[model samples]
Target chain A: MELVELLKTVELFEGLTQAQLQRLAEISEPARYDKDTVIFEQGQQGDRLYIVGSGEVVVRVGEDPRSARTQVYLGRGQIFGEMALLDGGPRSATTVCSRNGTQVYGVSREAFTNLCKSDTAIGYVVMRNMAHDLSFKLRHHNLTLV
Target chain B: MIYKVSYVVSGGRHPGAIMNEYERPQLGDRVEIGDKVFEVTEVLEMTPPRGDFQYLHVTVRLVDENENP
Candidate 1:
C-alpha cells in the first residue's frame, strides 16, 4: 500500500493533514504475515508495535486453557500492542494472524518514544486516544463477565 | 555509569509485574517511562539473578516536574 494512503487509515493520524500523514508514514516499517503465525508471544521482549493494513488478527491473553482470555479481532487500519510500545515491558498478550495478512506499518520502541517526546501535539492525541480505548476495553470485559 | 533503581513500578497487576522485574534504582538518579518520571530515594545492596543477569534492590519515589525533596 502507498505510504500516504496507509497513514490516513490509522486512528493515530485521524486529524492530521496529508502532509503530516506523509511525514509519519516515512517512519514505519511494513511487514507481512501468514495465517496462524505468531506476531508476538506473551512474556517475550516487545519492540515492534503494529498496525493492520489488511485482513484480521487475534489477540489472546493467558495460557492454553483455564486462563483469563479475550479475542480482539482487528481489521484494516487498527493498531495493537500500544501498552508495550509505551512502556519497556514484556508482551502482555499474544497476537496471531487469524487469516493470511499484511500490515503496512510497524514501529520500534525507541522511535515511538522519541516521537512522543519530540511532538507534543501528536503525543497528547495518541495518549488520550489510547487511554480511552483501554478504558473501553475494560468496560467491555466487565460486561462479558456479567 | 550503570546504576540500580527501583521506583514505584506498578499500580496493579501487569504494571506491577513489569516494574518488579525491570526496575532497579539508586539514590540521586531518575528514570522516565512514557510520560511518568520516577526518582531513586534509597539504595539497597542486594543481588538477584534473571537468566544470566544480576540485579540490585532500590527504593524510589514517583515524582512530577514540580516535586522537591
Candidate 2:
C-alpha cells in the first residue's frame, strides 16, 4: 500500500485527514531490515517513530542482546518508538526484524515536532491518537497482571 | 469464563502453545509452557464466534523469560 494509505490504517494515524497523512508521508523515510536485524536497542537515544509497512518486527526488553526477551510482534500498520518521540527519552525496548523482508517508514522527532508546531490541528489529532494507543496498551497490560 | 489461547514465539524455534485465556493475554503477561516461561508481548488477532457466539479466537506472540528478565 501507499504510504498515506498505510498510515491511514495505523491506529496512531486514525482519524487524520488525507492531507495530514500526506504531509506525514512526505516526512517519512522508507527503510528495510533483513531478518534477525536489530533495528534499535533499549536505552539508545530515540528520535524516530517507525510504522510497519510490511513484514514483522519484534519488540524485546533486557540488558543482554544475546538473550533479550521478546515483548511483542508488530505487523503491518503497527507503530513503535512513539514514546521516545513524545518524551525525548531513551528507547524503552529493543526492536528487531522478525521476518526476512521487514519494511518500515520512519519519521524523525525533529520533522514531526516541526510539523506539529506548524499545524496545531495535526498535532492535536496525532497526540490524541497516540494517547489512545498508549492507554489501550496500558489497560491490557494491567489486565494481564490482575 | 475460560478461553483457549494460542501463541507463537517471535523469532524462536518453538512452535508456540495453547493455553487458557482467562485474563485476556496482554503485553507482559508471563506464561509457562512445559519448562519454558514466555512473556506475552503482542496480541495478533481476536476472532469472535460465528453463529452461536462461543469462545473468541486469540493469537499472541511471546518471548522467552530468560531474554525478558
Q: What i-RMS does each candidate reach, in Å?
A: 16.1, 9.3
What's the CA error at residue B69 for candidate 2, in Å?
Answer: 34
lDDT of 1 by residue, A1-146 (tens): 68787655455555566765665676788888887788888888888778777665667788662574544455465577877877879889888776665453687877766776877676676677567446544543333333
Clashes of each: 7, 4
TM-score of chain B of each: 0.47, 0.64
Off by over 4 Å in 1: A64-70, B1-69
lDDT of 2 by residue, A1-146 (tens): 77887776566776678899999999999999888898998999999999888777777788898887656556666678999998999999998887777889999999998999988888998888788557545543333333
Instruction: State the weakest 10-residue window (summed lDDT) of model 2 chain A.
Output: A137-146
Q: Residue pairs in steric clash, candidate 2?
A: A69-B67, A69-B68, A71-B41, A72-B41
Q: lDDT score of model 1?
A: 0.57
lDDT of 1 by residue, B9-46 (tens): 32322120011222334467775432346665655544
